[model samples]
Target chain A: MSENKKSVFNEIIRPALVLTVITLVTALCLALTNAGTKEVIKANAEKELLRSKQEILPAAEAFSEEKEEELNGKTFKYIEGTDASGEIVGYIFQNSTPGYNGPVTALVAIDTEGKIVDVNALDLNETPNVGMLVGERDFLDQFAGHSGEIALTKEKAAENEVQAVTGATISSAAFLNSVNEGLAQYAAVSGNAPEPLSPEEQACPDAAEFSEEKTVEKDGNTYTYKEALGEDGSLIAYIIRTESKGYHAPVIVLTAIDPDGTIQGTATVDLQETPNLGSKIGEEEFMQQFVGKSSEISLGTLSDTSVEAVSNATISSKAFVDAVNQALELFPLVSGGAS
Target chain B: MSTDKAKVKEVFTRGLIRENPIFRLVLGMCSSLAVSTTLIGALGMSVSVLVVLICSNIVISLLRNFIPNTVRIPAYITVIAGFVTIVQMVIKAFFPEIDGLLGIYLPLIVVNCIILGRAEAFANKNGVLISALDGLSMGLGYTIAMISIAFIRELLGSGTLFGVQVIPASIPPIMLFALPAGGFLVLGILMAVCNRIAEHFGQPKAELGCDSCAAYGRCPAKEFEASQDEAQTDADRKIRKAGARAKRNEEDRK
Candidate 1:
């Protein structure tokens, strides 16, 4: 009986013993390799943050964080930048305000004399075309060198006045509010009060003329007090609305044309399309194609001539064309036949 | 064949293919799925499995003489866990990324049925040399299977195989293949395909002829054969004795 048991051990138990040894050896080698590659990964993350800061404040040679303070019941950071001789070059103030979607944050650069330098949208969670108007260079450039109370309107009542991007009324308002908030904080820290608004500057011309007491009728579209004021205001430079069955949903665009017919601003204030792929229509490149085009230009002709769809993003491109056509139709009415 | 050199060579060759751990024995499927997402990850997992397998097998085989039959499984587990902890600490200090990726799966190798199964069954009864060979082959077989699956999934899903793009830009790469669903789908297809290939190649089934074998009895196989032989002889004697008794009864009646 004992002899029989010995053979069983040789056949069954022996092979199992061999497998265990192989597993143990392999595990030891793997553990060694894993211990070698950790630092490289951490360094890569730090490099990315520095690159983003450089992109936004490219001119400033150096950057330093300022003390945190409360304004309008919200916390903000005042980041100061300096030149080679220790002179203050400019200041990057971080400010946030409630936007259409959520809080929008911006790094507003102000010169030593309290004049606006530039503004970079650090983090914004808002509708693409509607809320993105604040990022436009033309809209933000209006704030440069401005010191007094500012309001967004088409009328040139003061040098500090900023023209709102048409069709993105809410986003424009948010931008004005954040700029005001930033200036207010700067004043409180520097122990000075911001310059008061003048009589003409205080009243929004478009809002005053389009008051609730009066209404206007044009081409079967009823224009009310505020809505009519939006048209009369320089903010509503050009408005166009186009429709095409080619799109999955209706594409509506309201483009603000500068006096020279260049697309100073644009907003896809209304659109329901696929996320990411189709939604890229809200991107800069897509909007840049319309920058210099006139409101009268037919999108159908442009589709064959100028505007081209991004590769693999056909649905979004067609939707953009549809919205562009709609904007073109409303141009004469919104611009008061100026175009 | 009688020399020590010949015995070691025979043992080493058996693990390479004839008794492959993954293909033939079908063991260690947990880490096989978890770390096979990338080739580098698979390589790391393979090395770890090999180290643990070889060390535990060698230790268990050496201690086979002293281990009691009833307490053997517990003893084997303790040895395997010790090596795994050492590997884990060394990895955490040196390679944090891979260490982070492997995470809990590394220590889980201690309970992996393949490791403990081997220690309890083979190493406990075999010589150290044979046990080590078994560990090497099984580990290699598992590694090969894991990398192959990862390669196919990464290529189809991301247009990259092992992080290098293989597909052209014109083709819309299928993203779903990199997800968790793709892992199971790829593994299932690979397993079925392996079985089909084995069948087509006419490989001998490992579990055949166990019944009536001596290995099932005292020797497991020896007693099984002995029982069969005894039954046959008893039947033969009965047939002859019955015939003789019938003939004698016929003579008496006449």
Candidate 2:
């Protein structure tokens, strides 16, 4: 009888004992680690939230707890940004709007006077390097100054306009909708409608006059470049207008170069690059890479991750690079003859 | 006493060179390739993998005698997966930065062949101390392989080592090494180098396969075992109940 009981214990009780001990050991270790790190994890999460809020509203030294409210049809979470004295300097609105593939999220900030403080894109899940360029600083930073109606444009921006990322009109429109939603939300909560930019606040706000225009035919295309002077009659910029053959047809571009040889900006007069094989060259994101560049642009980049040849549109991409290089070369001639 | 100590030393040392998990056994190539794009990511992955490997090895070795041969692999994987999850949580809590660097590799560690292979081959048959040594030895070998691959990848591909740039920006870092294609190229050449060095030292070639499976010749014996399971007296039923519990753990694994 005792022998039978011993056999049962060996078969069942001992095996259960070993497994139980192993489970208990693992559980205890995990529990201890969880307990030890609980406070630090909570603190890190809070720190991250405050940091994100502060990033969009740099005028504020701290941020209040998030509070949500409905505006229009969408819901938005807002945090009150406080200065050293604890006065609400601005409101940081956390908002999202559906884009091409996913929701575009942004932290849009507005101050007491209804001017945009800054914008921090929290997430952008569009096409890589193309639609995703909406999250790029050069693009989001376009929303930093203006408030009220923001319109997307391919031509030179007026005071109330923002350039859309090239090859990503849908994503750009979605991002614009997200920021416009934030502005509207600010107006609803603050009960003040911010005014749009004035006519004097155009892209070249200091421009006084355009120089005599000249055209040069180069590489199977015609280049028309001119100089613009400041209000004080000093050489302000060189606006170079040219056309190059894209994969499908010929497209025109107008680029503004600072007299110092740095590109102020590039505007597509017309673009026929994307929807087939996208040469994102005419997009604001690609042109933004050349905004401060003085050297002749090339197809493959050595240093910049922001600069890339648009895949499947290598020919169109090379054509755009050559066009930009041609403008950079023409900048010298325009400035030398500026009077 | 001296012979026992020598045996222990040999078991540990052989994993480092003669049967390195990456270069010798050719295990865990997927992870080693993916995470080796950056030194910090590779180091983070190796450390996390090392933690799970050592913990699971010890636990499995301790429970070795109680587990039935047919249910052993399932039991081992359950324990390994549980530890892998806990390690990821711990990394998230303590070193969230390294946790981010680890990215998908944290979950991928659960499926790493080296961890399961070592448990099946060595730990299940070995003593507790020897099993722990095998885990440590195998883990260190993995670490060596990861760091070497990462060092080349990061330095040449991104012009950085451990996230610090040592190469001048004027010299373009080869972007190929940063991509998956470059990973295989580097892994192949390095494996060849490690092989040559091992040959120079007269290390015996590692025999690779599933020969160490406890149920190696028993694939066709499943029906026989089930019949035996039924015909046995009351004691066998109790053991079968434990095997059922092992199946439940296997379900939890998915």
Candidate 3:
């Protein structure tokens, strides 16, 4: 019996039996622990969510219980924020969007006036020192007390323009998308489904294919380029966007180049150039100067005229011409429309 | 009574300095380096490990006779992982802050070689009381090592101790100390300091990491197999008997 047990039975069966006993006892202990802590864990998670909602909507003293709904194939939880008088003041919702490095989640608060009260990113994890800066004060503060259609810009424009974190456009866009998701969810809940976007509201609204982001380096400045495919899958146009020094803040221009390498059109997308003087770059007469010019188009002296500079707004005119020149230089790369 | 007390004291206190888990023995370096960035994190991890180690030690010691040597590792694992889960649940319930600080490392204590080493080397050979004391003292040694590293890292990296501003505002904290590279730098310097002090006291040089484990140079786990000698046991005897009966029946038919 001793020999039999030593050879096989003791080695396998006995060990298995002992291990089974240990595992069974361990399982019982863990089951007890789970039973004891299950409710507290749930409570802690709920309490954390509530605190986040309160922070996003600072003016709201209290919040209603979560109202869950399915929108765009994602589950959204919305809580109504109430004031001291118990009157519903705003709605806060959490939204998660794919960020540059990971999934970005944020709590968005929009008041009764359809203005974004604030946005608070929850446990943001993005590329540190760059993309992660979206959760910082300077970037997030841009969302406060804003109304109307909101968009990010590097330069300056009129109503509802927020400056994005420089060099972190993707992460900033993720944050913006997070807020937009919340807005869409809230709009659905309030039965205020927004109208479908107009053609102009779409990026390259008339194009067949979506934009493939590209960039060009010139004169110590980076010109962001987006290319679209025309109907029947041909290279359509290259839209060059760049920021250049103007009378005040930087003037931002979007210059379009045809596949054959000539300027299709120029638009002053956003500029903080001085009003009436430097702002003339956005006007048709000033932008028209480079409509047919190629990469050869240079900002002529104030009077010397190949493409005449904007009178008294030379700096702003130079900014416009610089964008067109960047387009002209980049046109060859995508000239065959194969890129 | 006095001699008995001294024996208990010697067995327990040996783990504190002579066989210190982190500084001298250097087992479980992964968790020590990862979570020692903040004092709170260090303290939280240490206490969690303390509970699991002590409990697992006592359990393994009590079951020493019942567990076979060949399958002891797997059995030890089951016991250790069980305690770690319980620790995780308790921390999640009552100490959510520590739960967040320790993150994945809390449950990772199951794989910590320190606990496994002690179980195989000391617990399985000793009584429950002696094993528990070993676990306590070793856990304390690990906790002290973690706290020392965290104290230095936090103080220099953030210019704060336990999240409170300590250094004057004018002295900007060195940002590198908060990073993983800084963790390695601090641990290396502290280890050197520890070894130098040990050498001054006439102690042999301590091995780093699992090398110090008693089972370090032993055969791999596959050696636990019974293939070393295929001695005919009861099953082989049954096969041999069945073969003889078949041969005899064939002879009678012929």
Candidate 4:
């Protein structure tokens, strides 16, 4: 019996004992570390949620999550944002819609007057330079101070059509659908029945206008290069609207050019950038340098160059310059098509 | 005493260049290719690997004497996986953006060949301090390689340096560099460059196939090299010639 006991210890019992001890020690160490980090992780998630909420509902100093509410045939969660004194400030809704690439998640805020304060497209998996234009102020700012089922359009405003980004109709529609869903949910919850706009009424902006004689699509967007006729019907110059991707968002530029493709005038239509830094690209002083410059204008390359980069916002300045360069590059293609 | 110091230096410096975990040794290629698209992703993976490798190596070295030979691999894996889990949990809680970006790759570090290979080859046979040093150096080597790959990929791929735009917008960004294929391309080019530099300094040119690789046994490259050596040996050649002659003689008798 003593020999048997020694054999068991030598052969089977010892390895099992060693493995068990190692595993238990590892588990104990992991448990202790997990306990230490659990709260920190939770706090980080809450902080991000709070920041997103605050961006959409600026008047609210505090937020409380209400129970998930069902409205408009979909489930919605309303987060009530309150001021410091506990008075309700506005209602923020979390909604998502299937975008061009994947789901685009949004946080939509509604003031007490039932108008949309703003729509923040929070998490998006949309195509980077194309569908990502949904986050720009041009698209998002249009939703502000608007009430009822918000409509979208691609054509000239007909007292109803809100502009849709060129070449990214699907993304624009998906984002608008998310906003409309939030409004429907808000209406259901607050007992206010804002009339639902029919699906056909959600008009996306069109490329062709009454005066557009020639139009072509390039780089997933439509461009119409035509002569800007004077009052006497004589050809003045060429004008084109184009888009370019910046460091954080897209910037749209409407550039007018000579018939020979030299620059005439350039103005930014939509720009969402870091207020003081990247936004410096939009200053008249910075833009004026490109006024009479040729298509070959270079920044920071040649000593006697026509353009200078915005001091700290090199990327924004570059993006702005690139957009103008693209318009100049496109002039020949469009003019050739016209000839 | 001098020899001991030199030996220690060799062990530490070896992982940096001569036996780098990514470029030279070619261990842990999965995370090297997958998580190295951006600087943030690369840094996150490098730090996590550093923690797991160091902790597992120390623990395994301390327990080397008692673990049974038959169960050593399983026991080592269990230890490595535990450390990996702890790293994963801490990262998940603290760095959610990085955690989301790293996603499934963080948990996949448990199976990373470098951590397990170091345990089975070096840590189990060395002292605790030496094993710890090996882990730290190898981790640093991996970090350096990952950063180089990510820097090129992000710059050309997104026209950004560490998420800051560096490349002016005049040049169109090559979006392919941000993808997985770009990771492989950058790694190959970087490896070739490193080999060229090493050759210039009189160090041996880096070997390309797996036979000379330092992973645990059963390497196909190693097996192929062993067979080639056997064919080249005088005795093996003589024996094959004699066997052929014997077969011919038997046929003549028939």
Candidate 5:
């Protein structure tokens, strides 16, 4: 009789019974936890959102949800920032734009005067130092105090344009585009043109004042190339000066382009980079590789090119390439003068 | 009482170093490799595993008597998943940053071999309190291994500790240390160092590969038996060949 009972328990009931019991108990535990945490989670999310809203619009004491619009299946949220006395200070618009690897969402705040108060990059999955450089204070600050239809350029950022992050131009462009979308939405509702760049910050540093130079248009802006005279008073080679943002600081390279469009020499005008790593870019062996290469040498880790980047200093290497490419673009225009 | 104390101590200490889940046992390596990129990520993952492991062990040990051998695996899996779900909900609600960092790996802990292996090999056979103790020790061991690897990766990859800049500005961080390849390289070197240390202590370095692994007891293939059978057959063939050679020699003499 006992064996018969055991067989029944073993054959049919036990497996189903045990699994059912375990699943029910688990479900009970999870339900209890969910009950306790649900409200706290909601509150935490709201609190975080409010805190970020206040952070970009510091002048405003409170904010009101203005309106939201759906474009291309993405929600663009806009809020009206009000002062302590309940006066409208600025409008904060949140938008997400697809970046190099992923979508980067940004908060762009424009005051009543239509000038940008501040721009903050919120949720972003870009690579930490490469694409996420948009989070840097200096990079974000470039957007503040600017107005009008936002444009991103690699050139020295004039009043109307923002400079792209070196080696992360795509991400920078994406970040700028997200902000531009926010501004565009704000304009669509209010029908106000974006304020132009302020006059005080309009003058870009004069590259031509240093020497006799020839200006040529490359991607969008004019870059200057000058002739370097040897001790005998004859033209040695054309010098193209360009700057690249490195891991620590901007690396400026002056490349000498020969008449045949080959690189003659390269010199580091300014490089306050990390020692043993970014400093490798300035090493004789690394810079010498660019000397005989054509001005059009493609620069990347995977690309088949004559120049190889330093082992751990890929950012610095790319920056060096950008500076070299700037010089290359100047080569064809000045090839006649050098010859 | 003294022998009992010794046995308990042995169980606990074995997990801490002798059978570290990540380095010594090489279990739960998928999460370890993915989440050790940052110190906080490692800590969050370790805590999640700890919660699931302890809870599952206690439940399994308590239900050991009624659970039929035929349904043991499924029962253990349900218990583990229950705990894992609880952990996931708690983390998502309270520690959302960690939830984001761990991503799907937090849920994937249900399938981590260590938790189920313990349920089958240790928890089901042990008393509830002892099973819980075993789970805690194993989780701690895994946590320590994760922190050690993460410490190096975070420092070298981002030049930061706990997301703070501790390395001086002069040192350029090696980006490779933050990538997936760095995880594998660091894990390998750490395993080798641990083996060396274990050998130094006269604990024969843990047996290599899955055949001798403790987890293999639960493996459906019964791989350990197959390996044993292969060895026995090889031995039997050698003995038979020896007998044939001896017989040939005797016949020649005759």
Candidate 6:
């Protein structure tokens, strides 16, 4: 009887032990891999934030990240960029409001005089085609010169205020809410009533030329490139733009480059891909691959030499390449001089 | 003697058709429904399930003599989970996008009814070779069913099949067919159509039971079997009562 019981134990207990060992080893490996990749993932996220700032404040000389602060009962992060002389160039303020599908977070740049510089949609989770129209350039461009007192009412308003896009009413309203929140905070910080722009005085024609061509000579190499015009007419120096196609969408990137070719900034201007998978291409490590490459370099070469395509992000990477190629081609046209 | 071997082969072949995991047994509805929205998703899911099922069956059969009856379910689950984890990690490292699409369903395969049911009913009692065959046949059956459904859904819903647009540009595709509700509707109609075909051919309707159904002891086949046993007992009692009545009547006449 004792022998039979021992046999039963050997038969049953032994296989169970083997199975448990196998499971543990497999799980341990997974945990290890995840740990190994976590840092690269985090760096990728920071790169995206920097890139978004550059897109909205094209001419910002350098960005100074401010601690999160609350003004007028709303929370915001005030990022102020300055030129070589330590003068305030522009302010990139992060704000959010409820959009059609979910919260729409945006970064808006305003000059010292309180004129609209540019707006960048940082994160938007809305339905495709219908609510996604909020990210359209024409729609976002409406908030370019807006100030505190000007209401976002769709009428032909003063120079500072403009109409929202049709068929995307909710997205437009969400942007307005974010802008209003930013203005309120600015008022609190300055300890003064916010300035309002008159209808005739609102539009800043000079601001439009910031994205226009400029000639600059550096290290005996004269390059004519479009300088992103900041609110105060400071030249936005370092920029990099990359585009790749994802499995389900196009990936368009715009990044700022420091003189040394280190990534000064990066942002995903467009992405239409699978929700969780291909969308990860927009993450930091993937975009960080383009950090500091010369703007004169073609995006195709950058894509090849930089980060490998996320397995399913091939289509997205291709689209990104195309967008970058267009941005690179446009560089010469915008700058109008030989680099 | 040759006929006997043929009969054995026929029994094995029946699993591929008359007892298919998807069409006949309808064993793995969760994966079939979730990943069938896109052809690539379906293909990825099928490959993962196939690998897990085949590996688990082989391991279970090889160690059948060792598993204690009391802890058999837990032992089988551990084996299945080991294979599943391996598949998940490999996909994550190499095929992250496909990994994302398969998502939670890949891990859920640890509890897939078709796999566990085969392990318990066939692999435990069979030799290693037959058990492997059983796993392969069932997995293939599942793959075929899934791909067929995905082909239809992707083609009609998005005007494309396997990412290639097959339907003309003029035709307005029914987009909802690619959503969750569409998955259920397509699976239901497909199952019903399959059942109708089986009935027309006079084949016994394959039982519809999921892994969860078996765990809860509420499978339709189990219910049917219990009801049949109860009816037989009732008939036996009635027969004895009739016999008693006839005996009493004869005695009275005598």
Residue B79 accuracy (lDDT) in model 1: 76
Query: Where is model 3 more than 4 Å wrong at Cα?
Result: A1-8, A59-77, A83-87, A98-101, A125-142, A148-177, A183-194, A197-339, B1-7, B168-171, B206-254
lDDT (Cα, 0-100) at A103 in candidate 1: 73
Evaluate residue A224 in candidate 5 and report its C-alpha lDDT on the 0 to 100 scale: 68
Residue-wise C-alpha lDDT for candidate 4, range A34-81, written one tens digit per residue? 899888888888888899889989999999877588765667689888
Q: Candidate 4 versus the native: TM-score?
A: 0.65
Best by TM-score: 5
Worst 10 residues of 2 chain B by lDDT: B211-220
- Colliding pairs, model 5: none
Per-residue error for B69 in candidate 5, Å, reads 2.8
Estimate, for each residue in B1-254, the C-alpha lDDT of model 3 and write its tens digit.
Answer: 99979989877766666667887777999999889878999999999888989999999999999888888999999999999998898889899889888988998999999999889888998999989998998899898899999999899987889989899858977767877788899988887787777666556655654433433443243243345334436668789999999999999999
Task: Give the proportion of true interface contacts each model preserves, from 0 to 1.
Answer: 0.00, 0.19, 0.83, 0.58, 0.69, 0.10
Count of clashing residue pairs in every prediction: 57, 2, 0, 11, 0, 30
Leading candidate by DockQ: 3
Overall lDDT per candidate, in order of appearance: 0.63, 0.77, 0.79, 0.79, 0.81, 0.68
Residue A55, candidate 6: Cα error in Å is 10
Sort by TM-score, best first: what order?
A: 5, 4, 3, 2, 6, 1
Candidate with the larger DockQ of 3 and 5: 3
Candidate 3 TM-score over all chains jointly: 0.64
Q: What digit string (tens of lDDT, one per residue) describes model 5 on residues B101-200?
A: 9988999999999899789879999999999999999999999999999999999988998889989858978878887888899999998898777677
Give per-residue CA lDDT, model 2, range A1-67, as digits (tens).
Answer: 9999998777767666656665666678767877877788788777777887778888899888877
- Please report the candidate that would top lDDT against the real structure: 5
Q: On DockQ, who's better, 3 or 6?
A: 3
Predicted complex 6: CAPRI docking category:
incorrect
Better candidate by TM-score, 2 or 3: 3
